[model samples]
Target: MNVTLEQARALDALARQGTFAAAAKALHKGHTAVLYALRTLEEQTELVLLDRRGYRTRLTPAGERVLEHCRKLLEAERELEAACAEIRAGWEPTLRIIFDGIFPAEPLLRVVKQLRAEGAGTRFHVSAEFLAGVEAAFTRDEADLMVSVLPPTLPDLRSYRLADLKAVLVAHRSHPLATQRGPLKDEELARHLLLTVRGSDPRLQLSTGALEGRSTVHLNDFAAKKAAILEGLGYGWLPEHLMKRELRRGELKALKLASGATHLFHPSLHHRAGVRLGRAASRVVQALTGVELPTPP
Candidate 1:
């Protein structure tokens, strides 16, 4: 009940560093001080937090549970400090953004580079998620911005469309289907393997251009899918921007499919409607959407 931040920090360091000496070095404290902090923590909490019986000190099961809560406390403290820094600096401490994996990364990197050149102080955490995973990550992380293919379904959301991404069904130049002239028949497509990206969200049955009865191999990202296709392992849809050089050089050939050779995926940038944008986030929005947003007051 009376545990202090010092005690929690010592426990965390011990768990991470694995030994009293290491933990002490990490905390910039003497070994005795680190031991005392952890002992006091155990006394105050009435829990045997560490098991020192073995040659190596380890946390008891109870210690692990307490450490979890302690980690949350430490994280909240860090967030509080960041918030204060943001207030003084007039930039968000960090901007968390999640974008669809199908969307090209070059554009995002260009925006980030521009922001860095302009002396934006906000730190960036960017991730690419597939299908419903994009929205799930945005909500779970309370992300400041998201680029997603899913349309905004919530009333509290604001969205603007970016350029549509083009996905082309492709096969390796040496694959049997690559030589076929006319639109590929369903029966022929069925015989060949379809390389597809597995959705980042595990709970959802999300996929694109997967034929009903074809044999398929699921990969984690477009890069892997492209690799597999180029290796002649299978044929699948890949983002056009990703394989232009390969297509032009005959390393990969776009499949002429009966259903469709090309698929257009529309992605939009979204943020919470009522929340004011920080300077960095606003600049990023302008870079992506070409519409300047007002910075938070």
Candidate 2:
């Protein structure tokens, strides 16, 4: 049966002080209200709680057992309440962050270090995945934050542009495409095998060299795509950050199209705005990027 604070306190006070009037005084109640609390507790438990001998009241054997249980429970609740109060007065226990595959990992590591320096005592449990995969995490309550390339459709998610990146087509310097026409002409590009992300489809054919009839290889795995290009398997396009070091060494070179344009990757930070993310999740967004992320209601 359920026991209220007043019932437990009234019983404890009466046992400790030995009188109904004094127990009611200890509970800051009228003698009748204290009597009512005790009565309700007794009814719920189906146990006789007090023995009244004229104006004197004492605990029965059953009341004594109930009193022991009540005292322990009440003391434990009080300790929990005190601990919760301390938590509210100080800081959160931990923070969960979700980062996309494209979000610069090093920058996030720096942010974590900075947070530690500020004495937040906040620990971040990060779940990182591709932007598409990150959306799944939000839906399943697996991630508190999501950083990804902005999806054209996200009806229930909120996002803010956090950073920009450049996407470029690159190939091993030894590739046949790299040896093609000096000006890197359209006709020459069409003659070589093309590699691209499967989802982008050939419609994202950024290069006229990537004409409709060209031989092509579509890949979804990033590591495989990179390994293929490095082994002189084919010409491929990738986000610049992923190939930054190789590009620096001239092992790979950017493909320049007739239009002289390079692709840009814009990273968006997303969370289930106005609803899903807890307070610490929101705070981390503000604290890290100085941007207020939105939420769903």
Candidate 3:
């Protein structure tokens, strides 16, 4: 094929920017240059790439398929650049991390601030998952590092214990369950609505701190779960660190269950075994482990 990376890039930019003029501005090239690149690409491929049938510029069917491949090519180019940088310097161009919802944010923020202050040039992509969701992210290779309450038992994975997070079953002061004076029975607790975090895996539909066969309110994230509980919607377990203020102010009351009221979740830092981690990933692991920070590169 006579296609070049520049032609693919120009096509991708044009598709993203909608018009040749906008694409030219985005690529820092003249309008004629942008048009020429796309025109050359179509001629080489023997396909009409753009449809001018409507007022708005749209990609033809073949154009859409070619654009999709071009996007993949662009992504590969970026990865190539990052790989080159890693060979020259011991630093990664990007680091992706996934944290379970129960993991504390304060410490993570502090660590990120320190990384930034140290002039770490690595780009960060952070996301939050819950329960089995963390394991799913790791399994799918979505993140370079993961902080999870339940570490998957995969042969290719390695884990390091970071910290134990404490969780307590709590309810708003005005809730019916909160009025009970002593340890709650399973049946009594199960009678009320339970707010729980929904797992991402459709096959599993797993949950923590939730009773089966009970009326339940399922929220996608911890923040929403906390909000639902605060509104007296239901009682559910929350990370102690997240609700300490509410617990202290008596806005929420921790329940004592006959079985157990508190649970300790051991969160661990996990990564793929036998894979060399970049400098930024190494530093993040140290931060999570409470080890002394390494000298800045």
**Structural similarity to truth (TM-score) of each candidate:** 0.68, 0.56, 0.66
Q: State the lDDT of candidate 1 residue by residue for 155-244, as single tens digits.
A: 788899999888788899999999999988877888888876773222322233346345878899999888899889988878899999
lDDT digits (tens) for residues 105-155 of candidate 2: 776767677766765544577766554655666566646567776462557
Task: Rank the candidate models, highest TM-score first.
Answer: 1, 3, 2
| Leading candidate by TM-score | 1
Clashes of each: 0, 5, 0
Q: Which residue segments of model 2 deviate by more than 4 Å?
A: 1-96, 116-123, 182-193, 196-198, 201-224, 276-280, 292-297
Candidate 1: lDDT of 123? 86
What's model 1's lDDT at 10?
Answer: 97
Clash list (residue pairs), candidate 2 = 273-294, 273-295, 273-296, 274-295, 274-296
lDDT (0 to 1) per candidate: 0.85, 0.70, 0.80
Which wins on lDDT, candidate 2 or candidate 3? Answer: 3
Best by lDDT: 1
Which is better, 1 or 2, measured by TM-score?
1
